[model samples]
Target: MKRYTLSSLITRLASFEEALAQKMDAKGYVEAAERARRYASEIREIRDFIIVEMTLEPIETLDPMEFLDDAANPEEVDNLRRRVYTKIAEDVEPVSGELADLLRRLSS
Candidate 1:
């Protein structure tokens, strides 16, 4: 299975919301309304899973240079990456079973 980052999922959800808004503004009322409802449901599920299951704390923005600093350890970075991947894989499954596949297709 492909690995997914929380940031990527958040970005996709933003894009989906934008597209749904545009559709609603366009002439496709019925279809757009249906899609909007579905998107809302999906977003709710993701939010609930993140908040309830993961009990995620507020994310802090880190500078790339901080990770790339001369004193930064490679092993530590690898360990952090593995932990993030494991968390995403475990937490996202209950909310969206097709999330990994959707992310793969989107990237492709």
Candidate 2:
């Protein structure tokens, strides 16, 4: 069984959110969507990375700029964001148990 560390998950979540913000600032909805999609994809990868890093490989830190690069195009990022959000919302539903709370904050 693989151990899941909360600290690493928190780090990856923060990084993903930060990157999404940068993607929004750098581009329009489309680019933002693309970036969001990639971010979602990478989140899963990061999860896997966390599991592996705990047992096998050492984790490599990301460059500050790495988060904002591919997702900088607004239109692309927006599309990605929508898809990613949909997927993530579904995946996180059971554990979070606070969709309304999240939505309220997100809307604010």
Q: What's the TM-score of each model vs. the native?
A: 0.33, 0.39
lDDT of 1 by residue, 1-108 (tens): 333345455554445444444545454455544544555455545544443445223333222222222222324323433444344434555544454333333223
* Candidate 2, superposed: residue stretches over 4 Å from native: 1-11, 23-70, 99-108
Output the lDDT of residue 6, model 2.
37
Error of 2 at 87 (Å): 1.0
How does model 2 fare in lDDT? 0.43
Q: Report residue 86 deviation for candidate 2 (angstroms).
A: 1.0
lDDT of 2 by residue, 1-108 (tens): 122233453345446656676556555555544544555454544444333333432223333233344555555444444444444334443434243123223323
Off by over 4 Å in 1: 1-4, 50-108
